[model samples]
Target: MKKQTHTVLKNVFGYENFRPLQEEIINRTIDGKDSFVLMPTGGGKSICFQIPALVFDGITIVVSPLISLMKDQVQALKSNGIKADFFNSSISPQEENEVINRAIKGDLQLLYLSPEKLISVRNTWLKQLNIKLVAIDEAHCVSMWGHDFRPEYTQLKVFRNSLPQVPFMALTATADKSARKDIEEQLGLTNSKLFISSFDRKNLSIEVRGQVQKKKKLQEIVNFIERRKNESGIIYCLSRKNTEEVTSYLKAEGHSVAFYHAGMNHEEREKTQTDFINDDTKIIVATIAFGMGIDKSNVRFVIHYNLPKNLEGYYQEIGRAGRDGLPSETLLYYNMRDFVLYSQFADGGANSVMQKEKLNRMLQFAEAKSCRRKILLSYFGEHLTDNCGNCDVCENPPKDFEGTILTQKALSGIARMGQTDGITMLINVLRGSNNADIHTKQYFNLKTYGIGKDVSFFDWRDYVIQMANQGLIEIMYAESSALKITPIGWEVLKGDKTIRLTVPTSPSDKKKQQKVAKITTGNDTNKDLFTELKKIRYAISKEEKVPAYIIFNDKSLKLMASQLPVTENEFLAISGVGMNKMEKYGEEFMQVIRKFKSVSKPRKTPTTDKTFILYKEGLSATEIAEKRSLSITTIFSHLSQLYSEGKEVELEKYVTKEIVDKVRIAFNKLDRKVELKPIYEKLNEEVSYGEIRLSVTLILKNE
Candidate 1:
């Protein structure tokens, strides 16, 4: 079973190994057992069932919620030489009948349908076909506790009961523990194995910029887009009007961009999505209606122009970037206004309490002073032991001070106001604002009311937020977002316990925060070569009538440019390269590589070139190090550098796969830096530094 599954994975899907728990999940499903998989987006959830579908004699039916997702998945599958098709409203009745006939005739290996389509066809045409496995994509939609619940998914319980003989696998990218339990209950899975993959996407750097003026914020966004320069990105807005406004602003700023929202007609939305997916359009400013189940792997960044309603949606949306496992960026611009606006929207919902709580969590994440990734993962019930150095907080941590007096004053104001008002009112009271409400309530007469008049309203707001974050106060969302003092607040108010808070960063102070870090695509791949490969991919996409990623993602193209794979066997060794792809697209890509190599300059360092020569002359890196009287660490560094420069240095000769894996694991735990000292320390000094350097290079190459 393992060999067959591996063969399918390699020869068909072009992957060398199963991601964590993917093999286990596949084996469980093949054994006629139910399983639930909670993996992050771009975490290879589709492969879990795609492999089983290929291995099984009967067709595997996939229940997806989006027609775009089905079409994309089916196209990708067909490109890999897998027999797959979809039945959805997007297709004509004749086309649907053809798909149905193919399934009934045992010609199709996998079939995808929407939940509504599945429910409609289950008793009639679905039962006539042989079914081996039923995989539900976006399984979170089935649970009311989930962020994006759909009523059609609740009817799937009937389908589950009827297909008792078939194994069931429910998959989602973002589900908390409550949602997980709800899904299992809804699916009627008995003793099912549940797998929750790590929710951390280390390649994406998270940043939240707040309290900037609207004009400055728009300029900052323009500056951000300018820095990326031709990379694809998504700027998520909260409303259709915002999408249009952002789209027009970017267009006026001379960018190739478009807008997408629920308000757009079907054809308009489809064309916009297609243009973005095909790379004809570079930036997409859209509402949350975009990017669900989008398989575009080359998106380099994601920006949130407004605050998202919940952490799950925000995480899932940001997960859209860097899907190819290359370094990417996520920038969020939010303020107190976004919070209040979302709070008002959440106020009248059926799940108002839950909605407000989730919104509060989202606001906390935006206003957080610690690692943003840690907060996001913890919300999804995945805890990280160490601070992720990939967020703005980790990079530009705010300064802390003894803020006991400040916290006490703020808490005192809230308490004196009877804790009846929210953050705005509390700030007003603290800053001694002469607003009509304050004058009507005669709040200027109170002791706490004019005591903090020296502090600016913005500064007061920041201090209050810092206090809330520190648990010195709480916001009662159910009661019009009233401010309430916590047990810790009393201690701070009475000076029994001292509290430290981050100094409020004014707009001018934030301007001095370090400039955005340089975005790393990959290790020194030839940019010219990458560009040429994209051109070829775009041409092929136009010819083949599929998204460019279906031909080859940017990661695969980067590897091609780095490795300069000129032979069929060498091409197959590239990540995302399989026998089918190698046979189909090998000659064209290899020709490009060959031409570039022939014309490209060597651009070599003398010392590294000398080491490369000796290593190429059948000398191991260690042997060369000993022969040249150089340190092994220096020799390994030379080889890694040469590898990054497109030279084939057999890394396996210097380090065993197990050693490389251990070093890679340790390297991931730390911030992914080129320095080996941190990784060496993280591995407890068990692995040699030379091996760590070589292993890090290999990991980046494969990524």
Candidate 2:
């Protein structure tokens, strides 16, 4: 006669019906059945355990990995009106005692403990309380082969054996065949029932954007963020310094952004989390150190500024977005250097057996030809009805070619060239180059030398990358890009196997071959029109002391170009010009709008939702559409729905003409000024030079 969990779901959780698989898992857990929950990030994985714990007679123990995650879950649980707490070294002995007392006194339904904390001296006998359920989140960490492995996860098996009567569950977003098996074994849940939801997210478009230079790559990211303005999003950088660098860059660009990493003080990290959660900020540039339980739902996009260590890490990170069941996006910025670095870490060391396997799985995943989404689903033993056409590969499939002969020649050439020469030198030899090295080695006339004259250096390099991915050509980074043939490669070169490779397409060709982007402003030479409008918007922002986006968004600015509303009444008709802004500073901005309106003659409604999210959250619908794997029209449709439903406030609070002018002036002066630090620092204090710079950049780069 436990007061029905479904009732709690409807009343407190506010869900009339649990999404598929939720109730089954919850009921099983409440019945003390050990469970293996495989729900995706936003799939209500926590509900399965949180709900069951509500009905259980004892406190439910949640074993988490990171301090951030533990805190996030506890906070979310409290928000849901559930009694939940977490124990970590962050608290003093007195605080620990209070938490323990709460659990023992039946005042808490859920208690989150980091795996490291549980195995610590202070918490050794912690579980001696009336614990009924033990939920291990990010369960794949227990597997030595998972992306984020912890040695302490192995000790979870001991906890299960010690607390045998209590039910246990483990959850993760991305675990392939081997990692899943290892997690089950390591968690001592071999006999437990498994509950797996679909791994593929139809709305999440996956893609690897390759070969773009750093400046262009960053510009692409900025533009993407600008296109979708103020929705919440996370940008992942691979290194600690990079996290800080990106955070600084975005902040300088005029977005309210913050950084988080293992290198940061715990307090600073906590504050960053708070800023992001409270909506004081919308963008978080962080290292992998940030996720795993850091619950800030409604994140619209997750971009990997640097490639993730592995697909498991990539999957879990991207899973953070669209957790509220709305469309979200996932973009991974990949470079071959990232793979090489991760590979070097794999040759033994203290690397867990599972970490090694997961690393290999990620390698396999990167090389996968079938739909990226399909491979992910199939790995978890789920079947896909058809190819997921949401990934970059699916959207623009690299042209296919019969590389059987070329691959054979490359492998033979590498062996003959002594595994010491890098792909470049090897390729040169294959294509019959008589460079200094070849002339000095007296090897220019070899049979393979110059045989590949027909192949361009770029295409030949692409061939090498594909070969490295195929395991036919193993990369040797220790000695300057050397390509060594593997055992399988020997079999292939010996004509024992069929080797077909997909050539990596050149993104530049498509980009360059396209027509110049057409900007629909009212005047081309009167570029001064948009510039003048920006100056007015900047001026008002300075007086108001807010981000320029608060005054007039790109859409509104574009609308002003078309409508030219000189009066407040007419300006109000232009979208984004509501009552609040009209009262505050509408007269000045409306005048600027009127100046531009005389030319465009109101052809169509130019104000739009596309760049609105960008000005707010730095999301691009195309990127969003691509990241979420949804149709362009469908993403736009959801966006329109969201925009209409969201609260509409005044525009003047966020933007003005003075600040935009200042930012424009600052950029114009940077090259001329001897030192940049002083100018940028001064700008950060006013109209937030950091945020303005990023916006200005997006406008210039995309235009």
Candidate 3:
């Protein structure tokens, strides 16, 4: 099994190492045992099934919910030179049939199909195939208690009944106690291997900040990205409107960006996806609809402009970064509004018991403070011996005050009330305060009215959430109110481990790095030119559904105004221009160029000037390279973006073939070898003294 697995790993996947449990999981599966793996998103979950699938005696049919995810997996597998294919709605029937045929003939190692399709008669393609393993991915989706519960997942149980002989591996990134039970039940894996990887992504530093107004928060994000410019990353927003707004916010700040959401047409979403994969877009401001199949590994950061629905979603979303085993930042902009809004999504369902449990768990995750990594890991039944010295808490170490007395009083107040009111009413009761309404409720409780005078209601509420986050308190939330204390909280009140608690600062008070949301101006003609170009770009942008600058970046705009390309051909010849973009967007820009030429103000060729392509103020050479597919040497050959008139320098010494042609253009007819001043003056024309020096160098260097 080792030799076969190693062969597949190297010859097919080309990976020299197996991520943690991957080799063991594969070896177990290849030995023909049922396995259930719970690996976090960045844990190389694919390899668990993929390795076993490749080396197994027959086909391994992987059941997944996301079509895009299947495509991503298939593409990655194919790139590794492994035989993998997907049959989904996106594929033609003929193609699907071919893939099915290949599976039946045992020519394929892994076949990914949607759960909805796998149960269909036509896709009973699996019926005739000798399937070695049935791997159910996102297995928690089968449980109503899971964050992304899909009803179709329940059918996996029925499918399992049909093929009682086949081994099943149920896999998911998330599941608490309830969800874990549901996965085992739904998949009918009563006696399967349960391999749960710790849900701790120590490499990912999770920092949640809020109460910095949305615009300022966006600017903060911009500042963060600016510091990390040129790195790959994602920024998630809650709504399509927010996605567009955030994308605009970032692009207005001059970031290379793309936006994605369900509101977009399939084509638009596909285009954004393609652009991201092809490296045309460095940052994607998107809703949760994106990242289903995103396999790009070098994503150095993932920022959430809005809170996600649950910890599972948050975990998966943030997990998209640092996949390449590098340090990446996960910035979550959290607020109460997000929590309340997302609760509505999990609001109504037939499975009330499971739904209530799942929602409360998510709430706990958001409000957590002490060893956030430990709590997240413990959810998957993995214990951490020492604090993960990576998450926000371990880095800063929150202030731990004794909240034992406070907890007992809060619990006593709830007992006296005889029923559950929300946190607000409960806090009010414990503080021993009386409004007209409070007096109506028996003029105060017997034992605990205002008993909590030592603690503010706000601070006490913070203690409740922190206790809940650490599993010390539990919320008996449902259609009916039942606020019950958990066993841990009871033990603390009964003189246990002293209730030593480290409370997190109010998310509202945490200092977010501030940013100037509004773009300031330099109060110059270039600034005016930049403004005008942005307007023109905005108009074109509405039609293209792209950010304004993707068409003509700020540096490109500066290049156009400073170079003042007077003709259509010259406009096309400007850097970052191709024939298609030039024809469509160039007329309005041409007017600006013509307008600038008429004023006859001496134009300062920007660092991106065709004759000065090697140096620039605003853009790096990589960005220029990405914008235009031309190589570094070719771009350097077209330079005039760097030369100045009064600066005295010898052209022969600094000059290479890279700039020789452009250098030859600036020499004057008299060729007197004066300073570079003559050349800068005649730059708009064909000849200047600087140009003659190149001809002199061609002879002087040779002699």
Candidate 4:
């Protein structure tokens, strides 16, 4: 069964092996057991069930939350030669009937439907099919505590109960302990095998910027985008108005940008999403309504124009980027106003208390002085013993010094004032301000009143916020936003535990201190070759009417550029190339490589001493093509002729003895025709045409 799973992984999914926990989940599902998967976005959750869907004899029903997600996954699966379909309102009645009929006839392996459709139409068509498994995606949405709850998800239990014999798998990317428990209960899974993969996306470099003025913040975002020009990214705004404003600003600055919000018509929103997915737009300025289950894998960055409502939403949003496992970035700009607005909105909801608590945790994350990843994972019940060195805080940690006296002054002021005043009042009193409020309370006479007078107002505010984030002090939002000292704060005030606070830099100073690192394509990757490969991929995407990533992700193209595979076997060894893709695209891509190599530079003579010198200097064929202004095949030709002439050239070094033997045997095995293309095809195109040509020269010369 494991060998069969590996075979499916390679031949169908184009992957060499399963990602962590994927094989186990697939095996469990194939063995007719229920599973609860809590993996992160882009964590290959789809494969966990999709593989089982293929292995199962009966059709697998997948309950997806969003129509876009279903469509994207179905298209991707179809491209990989899997028979899949989706039944949703987005399709016409006739089309839906066609899909239903196909599923009933056992023509489809996987059928994706929304929870609403599954419950509303279960009796109409779903009951007629032989359903082997029921997989619920976005299972977190079933819980009221989830960040993106849907009432329709609550009705899924009825649909599951009707099909009690089928194994059920509930999967979500951003569920916490509470949401996980609720999902299992709501889905009615009994004694299910639980799988919780790590939430860490190491490719994402998380950074948070203290809110600057509007113009400065926009400029900072623009600067960040400019450094990663022509890459796909998302800019999440807190409101539709901000989305429009940011979209206009970026458009005026000559960026390929668009805006999306729930206020837009369905067609308009759909167009925006399609354009972004099709690579027609480079940036999307959107409210939280967008990006629920977007599957675009090449998004290089996700920028939060304002702080999110909670850590779950923030994590899910950032997870959209770097899905291809390439290095990406996430930048968040946060201020107290965002928190206040979020709190006010939460007040109107039934789950106000939980929402406010989640909001505060998000604020703590944004204002954290230590490693941001630690605070984030800790919320999801994962502990990281070491700091993730990828985040901004980890890369440029603030200098900490003994601030025991500073914290004591703030804590003392709060205590003396009965802890009823907010951060502003405490800061004003500690700074010894002659404000009207302070004088009205006659707080100037207090000993702790002027204790922190040496600290500036902004510095005092920053320090207090830091204290709240560090849990030494708690902010009572329900009590008119007052600050109360915690047990830790009491210890600090009593000189029991020393407090070390990071030195606060003013907003202007911090903005000036911003540093942008240069983004490189990869150390060993050939940029020129990579660009050429991208051109081929884009051309194929255009011809096939699919997204470029559906053809091959950037990671696969990078490997191709690095490895310079010119044969079918070599191409298969590159990641993401399955037998289907190899058969469909192998010849075309190899043609491009052969053309690039053969005519990259026309040879004036058959052999050249300079070529050997450059080769001996360890310059690869591609590198020598650029340095000597010769085609890669021309260089190979010169080396091959030199070897034939019994010169100092080492034939085995240029082409491995193993490959040389295979190519010679392949060429000699074919009779009456010694052509490179025929020999290439006969050998399954595993050996490059260039290698075949070189081998033929040597064979004829030796004979």
**Per-residue lDDT of model 3, residues 392-446, tens digit only:** 6666667887767777777677667764555666777777777776777773845
**Local distance difference test scores for all models:** 0.85, 0.68, 0.67, 0.82
Q: Residue 109 error for model 2, in Å? A: 2.3
Q: List the candidate numbers ranked by TM-score, top first.
A: 1, 4, 2, 3
After best superposition, candidate 2 residue 670: deviation in angstroms? 65
In model 2, the runs with Cα more than 4 Å from the true position are 1-3, 92-94, 116-129, 151-164, 174-191, 248-252, 351-357, 402-419, 426-458, 467-481, 484-503, 506-703
lDDT of 1 by residue, 556-607 (tens): 9988898787754457667898656776788899999889988876434456
Better of 3 and 4 by lDDT: 4
TM-score of each: 0.80, 0.63, 0.59, 0.79
Which model scores highest in TM-score? 1
Clashes of 1: 0
- After the best TM-score superposition of candidate 1, give how far the Cα of residue 286 lies from its true spot, in angstroms: 1.8
How close to the true structure is residue 459 of candidate 3, measured as C-alpha lDDT? 73
Worst 10 residues of 2 by lDDT: 512-521
| Total clashes in model 2, counting residue pairs 3 or more apart in sequence or in different chains | 60
TM-score of decoy 1: 0.80
Which candidate ranks first by lDDT, i.e. highest? 1
Better of 1 and 2 by lDDT: 1
Query: Which candidate model has the greater lDDT, 1 or 3?
Result: 1
